[model samples]
Target chain A: MFLGVLFSGGKDSVFACRRAMETDSVVCLITVISENPDSYMFHTPNVRWAHLIAEAIGVPQLLWSTRGEEEAELSDLRDAVAAAKKSYGIEGVVTGAIESVYQAARVQRICRELDLWCYNPLWQIDQVEYLRLLVEEGFEVIVTGVFAYPLDESWVGAKIDDRLIRELESLQKRYGINPSGEGGELETFVLDGPILKKRIEILRASKTYENYRGRLTIEEARLVDK
Target chain B: MILIVDLCHKAESLSKYEFVDPIASIVRRTGSEFKVRHFSELTAKEIERSDGIVLCGTPLKDDLRARRIELFIWIRDFDRPLLAICAGMQVVAAVFGGEIVPQPKIGLERIEILKETDLLGPPGEIEGYHLHNFGVTLPSGFDLVAGRAGQIEAFKHSGRPIYGIIFHPEVRNKWIVERFLDLG
Candidate 1:
């Protein structure tokens, strides 16, 4: 079956695209770029680079813009999925939702309304283990955002590896933070992975952090040969 | 050992990691051994060898498995402890003379336990994750353990250890599955 992945240039969505490719044809990547930094549903940090990620993965992308209102973004999502179905002939939509009922349920409802099957390949996954899996699966992910206490500015712009995962695991035990950033505590961007035909090289990036709320903005990046 | 039956649309489906593996993770965390088998690939030998059976849930859109109820007839004779979740609940109820009705639900909701049982403990209110497109009516010779008569959140056979719940326990109430494994 041909499928379209809800892409965000994050580790979860990129890994979900790989998982989808394992079982079905990932025909396109559906990207919803929200203007709101505090968007309720979609991820915001460096999502503009989703086109690069899509190009790296060698999949076509359908980029849709949204005002990022509370409920309006859902309609934009629906429109994006509808467009994917119409243009790419996608029979199903896949999401990277792990434990967020708020995000997963809305996507499920939209897919249902459009008469398309929705699959959450990472539903209810163990966060720490998932982070480890992402690393073990050869995904080079950089922490792009950090929200919540106990996670300082150093977390922003750090590469996710064994040391980072161990620190996150320790924080999970000490502070109850989701290691994979399920609670909006952190955000990630994938640079290289087993599913990517090309790797993304960050040329220049800027970080703005204050009081544990920070983001690493990729001002420039280019795809390099893996 | 607990045998987790995958009731997804097919074997090795995209839904397996979503629906089946989470339950398997819970069982593993509870320190119980388990083996997962697709409903279409299950065998009596494997079923008889297991101490208990857990029927895992499927995606909301994968109701195609429900129409193939003939594959679930083995559930009627297996007397060992069993627990059904969501799509599994529908199958168990259908095999036991219950009707499947369109009762779609998604996301977290408050579930009121109607009666005390070994699986769910005492009657009270608890939030559970629900992601099902259909709900099953109370089957014959089964007692409602939660929810009202028309909307059955949970049920168990009057005489057997067979149980069913409409919510996905892997979301928040994994102890229910742990308790079922402890029943062995």
Candidate 2:
């Protein structure tokens, strides 16, 4: 059956789709962009890069943007999901929900209202192992946002390498940071992965550290033809 | 010490405001130690040993089938100093005689304290962050500790030491955390 994958370009969503591909055909990647800087609903500040991930996965991507701070965005997401079902004729939707019941429940509600099957492949996987698998699979991931102590701007451009994993482990041991970067300690974006048909090369980038936070701004990025 | 129960199935994706930073700040301010244990990881011994419990917000909303809900039920019996945030608040209410219903879709609304209890003292209106669609209405025995804009914003168990606030006090104000710590 054809499926619509809720693609956030994060490791979890990508990994969820990869596992689902083993059993079903994923037809579209859906994402929601919230205008609010501090959105209680959708993933913020890092959603701009979702397009790159959609391109890498070589699937038709749909991004729904909303001015709704948090809950209002749910209406936007519902509208997008409905449109996707009508246009794509997909029978099921897949989510990369690792832990947030708030998100999973909302998605489930939408799916139930639409009469679509909701698939969550990484529903209960261990956070540490999930990060390990992302690295093991050679997904070039980088921290794009930081909001917790012990994780700051220095981590913005840091790669998800063995060294980073070790640092995360140490942080968990020392400062209660989750090794999976759950608890909003950090957020990431994938630059390259197994599903990518082309490589993304960062041509121009600027790193800024201010307001007790750090960010790596991609001034220029391009998809290199394979 | 505070024990944060990780009810989230995907704990990694939650924001720092929801769990990590608030707990860390509370620990630092109170000079108290804290540990995070997932619901699945906890043993009966661990539950009994907890002095003060903080139920961290889960990505999952009110899912009756969620295994974490069962764990919450087990913890409810312990009757230790308890605090539940967004999803945690909903779970606590559900465990008690309260019900969780969808809230109006609003962001950063003003929550007026209707009455005073030890939880939010002096009974004055304060602005608080709201991110949940569900609200709690306690049963007969539970005393209404606080209210905001006509809804029951916070409550205390009549028969137990249990307390809950619908708004995220830890994320909004330090006094809330301080008060919870004081209870312990």
Candidate 3:
């Protein structure tokens, strides 16, 4: 079965696609480009690089825009899935929701309305395990933003692996934050994965911090050899 | 608050996404806290601190069985609200002189609820998903509250909040643990 992945150019979405590839043929990467940085349903960090990341993964991407309003973002996702079904004949949609019932339920409802299967391989999954599995499966992910205490500007552009997993575990014990950043504590981007044909090389980037939260803005990135 | 004791096999084939996540999700959905620890790492102090405890599933490795048996004794003595699920239940039964018989491979099997208990929801027929290579023949004190024929589905400690269920409650009857939320 061919499926369209709801991509955010973040770690969860890319990791979800990788897992989806094991059981289904991933037809396309549907990325929602939200203008509102604080959008409730959509991920906005590093979303501009969806095309490059899609190229690295060798999947055709469908980019859609929205105002990123509260409930209206669900419509944007529905439209993206509808387009994927029309263009690529996708039978299902994949999302990277682990612990967020808000996101998972909305996607499920949208899929039900669209008459398509909604697969959430990471639904209600343990974040510590999710992050560890993401790394153990040979996926290279970098932190793009940190939005919680204990995870400050230092986490920006850090790669996720065993060492980072340990740090995240420690942070989780202290701050009770989501190890996979499901609580909006942090955001990530995948550079390489099992299904990716090429790796992403970050050429230039900058960090901006406000009110203790910091984001890594990618100025330049390109696909490279594995 | 709930404490989910992890007995999941840590073999290379198994990731850390133990069956406890779904159970913890139920706990979290009910606006409670959940803390997870490996059976070996768990201390009696933590057990005393938690409102309830969950003994999650794991492969019946010889080493795991030994550790789980030790933990089961400690859990029984603590006398806290406990739900021993799947292999966790087998460990509890094995500690009580019950025989753990390796069974034929089976899938979903509906079991009749012989009596009412807070551990399992409702009183009538309930379909449970089974995926175990082993089942327990209970000792003298344990009572069979729910089962399908000779196969024991659930057993109560006769006095405590402790329960042992052969089938996986997290998958099929997720609402099975809803009663456990109010336990603590």
Candidate 4:
């Protein structure tokens, strides 16, 4: 069956897409750009890079702009999925849902309305195993945003690898933080993966922190030949 | 030692698989050492070297399905403790005189074990994450041990160390893998 992935330019979404690709052909990547940075239902940060990463994966990207109003954004998601269905013949929509009952239920509702299968390959699986596979599979991931204690400014622009996974595991022992950043403790961006044709290079970036929250603004980036 | 026969080969063409990796983790969780080999590379000598076997599933692509059918027939006479998952189970059913038709209501369903067995260990409810478009019929001389809404979920040979399950034990039931390994 053909699939359309709701890509958020994050490790979870990109990795979900990879998992979907394992079983079925992913014909399109759906990216929603939320106007609200504090959106609860959708990711807003590093969204501008969704297309570039989609390009890197060599898949057709379907885009949508949402006003970020609470439940209204879900309608925009339906519209994006409709467009993908009409254009790509997608039989299902792939999501990066981990342990969020709220998000999974909403996406499942929308998929039910659209008569399309909602596939959450990462749902309820062990996060430690998920992070380890990301490293082993050569997924180039970076932290773009952090918004919790114990994870400070130093984490803002760090590449996630085996070493980082260990650090996160230790932090989990103390703070009970999610190793995959599912707790909104941090946000990530994927620069490359096994499926990507090119790798992204952040030539310039600036990190800022305030009151335990931090962000690395990617001022410039370019795709380099792998 | 157990052998994970990863039939999701022809990786140069087919997509990378995530189906059986969790099984690998399950093996490690049981403190078991296992080796993975592509189905094309599997041999009788290899089967003789292992304690048990787990045959993994893949999409039923025509060429790959042909290769799989050949392999199932090739290994039909295997007497070792063997467990197959999803597509692998479908392969077992097709090879052992059973039916495989397109699945009608394909979604998440709770499977209840209808019969008792050491491999299931007092089975009551097992959560099955269903995705395949096909369903398998009980093969000849096999017990219909599990089902959901009358659809078959598991079956075992009448008198052999072989079993086939429709759901992914790696996803929801680590105990099932442990039980299968224990049969070795």
**TM-score against truth, every candidate:** 0.98, 0.55, 0.61, 0.72
What's the CA RMSD of model 4 in angstroms?
5.4
Worst 10 residues of 3 chain A by lDDT: A99-108
Give me the displacement of residue A118 in model 2, in angstroms: 1.2
Which wins on DockQ, candidate 1 or candidate 4? 1
Model 3: which residue pairs collide? none
- Candidate 1 backbone collisions, by pair: none
The model with the greatest TM-score is 1
The digit string of per-residue lDDT tens for model 3 on A42-147 reads: 8888899878989988899999998999878778878888998999999778888776656765776677667776666676576787888888888889999989
> Candidates ranked by lDDT, best first?
1, 4, 3, 2
Give residue B16's error in model 2 in angstroms.
Answer: 29
Per DockQ, the best of the predicted structures is 1
Question: Candidate 4 lDDT, tens digit per residue, A90-114?
Answer: 9888888776656766776677667
**C-alpha lDDT of all candidate models, in order:** 0.92, 0.70, 0.78, 0.79
DockQ, all models: 0.82, 0.03, 0.06, 0.07
- Model 4 TM-score? 0.72
Candidate 2 at residue B44, lDDT?
79
User: Where does model 1 exceed 4 Å of error?
Assistant: none
